[model samples]
Target: MGTVIVVGAGIGGVTAAVALQRCGWGVTVLERSVTLGEVGAGISVWPSAVAVLTELGVKGIDQAAALSGPTALRKPSGRWVVGAADLGVELPVMIHRAQLHGLITAEFGPGVTVRTGYLVKTVTQDDSGVLINDELRADLVIAADGLRSVIRSALHPQYAGPRYSGYTAYRGIADVRADDGGETWGQAQRFGVTQLIDGRAYWYATANQPAGQGGDLAAVIRRYGGWHDPIPAILAATDTALQNDIYDLTLPLVPFATGRIALLGDAAHAMTPNLGRGACTAIEDAGALARHLQSAPDPLTALTRYDAERRPIATKLVKRSRQIGQLGQLDNPLAVGVRDVLMSVGASAARGAAALRKMKQSRRDHSSAGS
Candidate 1:
């Protein structure tokens, strides 16, 4: 077996390297930054990815994170629209992005090497192997870089870049304790919070702000500062928050693998965070890729199998995530009214109970299929 070169050391890259190394493949991770770290605030992992993590022997996530509470969907006027009590699954578990990164990076020991500050220039692949910068050769190359993947561009030069979803997001983590999860829906704006295991809260607000405009936390406070209980307090206690113009790629969700070189995570299918599947989906991608590679006969065949199995599922998830974001960002009066009505009607205790049942069934189906 030859060495596998994985570009970028983000969650997806690290997970891939770890999984491949466990399968007896030599792995090297090249990261552009000087160190391995996460800039984002928080991430939610769903049960699908959690199962994958358990299979991979990645531990401590349960202790470092907190399960999200029932989500309270409210109207712009602060009226209760829907409570996530009906939604299926454990409302995604929230963990600081840095904490998750640290956990994944700790798993790379003898067979895996991580190199930082190595900005990849180009990639060329032949029948025998792939070469990075025309110098290093490997039996396989994994482009887990990110949405702005340089390797992706080299592979698909004619493909379009990531498209902005016409919205901006503001996120902050505060050191305040809260009992229940919170969410407020306003015309063209939404705010929510999840309490971390440390008792601190990770809150986020999204609005129809201008692209590239830095989020003004003070302005957000002034606009939505008067909403409901706990929000005012959460914002008041927030020492700092990061803001960014939310964007999603318009590319068709397709298999990103080309021969022995492959793409994973955001590089493969970057979607909105509305459904909270961003990190979870990436983790699932790592798991699926690893599983295929371990069982396949050769590197090339394994990469192909990974694409065939993952492309359809990931594409559907991408579409669902975008739709959810669009629904939350609706500002029209009539549309907002309809959305609120649907939420209220759909958020009953019975509905929630039914959702949990369905979720359990779905998990079983997935497990059976994988087996």
Candidate 2:
């Protein structure tokens, strides 16, 4: 066990700190912000990420219940395309981003130290150790500095960085009643609503727009107001809206590790949020990196193993997420019609397959009981 400096104090950065500390490493987390906390509205924590947090001793998340109501995809007029249960998909537990961040940071023990408002301008490494900002030094560096990470640029200067997805996203938490929640697909635009653990509704929407086109709550309302039901109500209840021009890292992502530095989370693999797996993937990355470090003979060897284990999976996720976004954001009438029809057909087939399996299991159970 040795000293490590984790760049950025986001969810992924803090998670890496906790995992590293549990493995007997002294951890220091650096953040450029004046204060430490997340700013997002709500985030989905799938079972895989929940398990990682449990292994890291994060508590209170298990109490945050998963989605109980059926989640479905619909046309702008509320016609169902597919329900998540029809496809046997497992829904994730939705928690407020700030709450989740707090739970993870609560696990920070004496071995963990945090430095807020510290911007990492430079990082260099040798066989012995890694250096940061010309002064701070650590045996290893975990760069969890998010999509536009400076460390990532310094390491892979030749790599293409963030790529605009030709759309902008809007998100907000609404204090309104929405029992059953899911997504509504429109021509080149979409709206999704789900209940957070606290019972408040979390809603997000996307529109095909050029980058840097600014928008506000009014803009979101104008776009999605007349489309559906609870969507208008949800927006009316929201006091503020957050808008971001969606961007993901370019394909053929940079390696996760090099020498004494390892990239974690968005720094290594930033993907579109179409699959809602970006944060979950980062959590998995932290868990895997810690496991490899504990078993390997040296830090360098551990990073190599970590890269080999995580990169392929991350690559696949990035590709698959991009594909989903493309399909969901179809604008042309013919293309949208074709996409919806195909999705509906696929969902019907999935339902049939699931029923067949259930019937088979029931028959086996009855036979065993009689015997």
Candidate 3:
């Protein structure tokens, strides 16, 4: 067994801690915050991430509500561009961010220790291990510090990090019971709605805005109130809103591993929330790190394997999410029209394909019955 220090106590770092502890490693998680918890309205935990959490011994994820009903891509006027079911894609379960965080952290066993308000101002590594602030040392370091990760900046100062996406995002949990859920794309703005496990609706919106231009729930209403039916209702039922200027790591993200420290989650690859895969990706990273450590000959080898396995996949996601955000946030009238039309065409094609598959299956069943 080896000693490891995990920076940041967010979902990714805690998941990493639990994974490492289960693998017979003594894990210490350090958080700069005064207390341990997560902030955010709602998050989607896709099946891939759920598998990773299950392997790590985290429970209660199955209790989250699976997305039901048709999720659609729509215009601001509530005209549908595409229905999600037509695409034949799998959807994620919806849960409150805090509830999901609590489930992951609860899996921390006696082998894991946590220190809050402990910030690592300086991190240096030598041939033996990595040192933090000249006080704590560990055989390995897992940096999950987040999008503006201090550890990442220290490790790769030359690399330009945290590029803004030319849009700001708003998130909130609304008390309304509206059943319809999906996204509506307008000129330079977009809104999404989905029901959480608790029956509260979670809604998120994005607007083309300058970085650092702050906004709140009222601002969200002002921007999207007139768009559609439940959009206004959801806003009216909301008490508060969270806003963040969207940002993703610059293309060619820094390597996930350098020396004894391995970057996980947003530290390794941060992307826009367009795909709802940010936290899921981080959970996957933690799982991969632990898996590699179990089989590899040494910690360094494990880190190398982790880097190789995770980087390319994360890079593709970062690129794709950004592109989707660009398309969703189109402001130009002509461009928006074109995008909507293309989406409608794609959805129709997908529905036709799905119908064909079903028809073929039905024919096979009928022939078997005759036989």
Candidate 1 least-lDDT 10 residues: 82-91
lDDT of 1 by residue, 165-224 (tens): 878888998889867687788889999888888999899999986788776779779878
Ranking of all candidate structures by their TM-score, best first: 2, 3, 1
The list of candidate 2 runs beyond 4 A from truth reads 64-68
Pairs with steric clashes in candidate 1: 86-352
**lDDT digits (tens) for residues 45-156 of candidate 3:** 8989999999888988878555644688888898888987776878888888899999998898899999999988999999899999999999999999999898999999
Off by over 4 Å in 3: 64-69, 365-371
Find the 10 residues in a row with the least total lDDT in model 3: 61-70
lDDT-best of 1 and 2: 2
Q: What is the lDDT of residue 232 in candidate 2?
A: 83
TM-score of each: 0.92, 0.98, 0.97
> Please, what is the whole-model Cα lDDT of each candidate in the order they appear?
0.83, 0.91, 0.92
lDDT of 1: 0.83
Q: Can you give the lDDT of residue 256 in candidate 3?
A: 98
Model 2 residue 167 CA deviation in Å: 0.7
Candidate no. 3 TM-score: 0.97
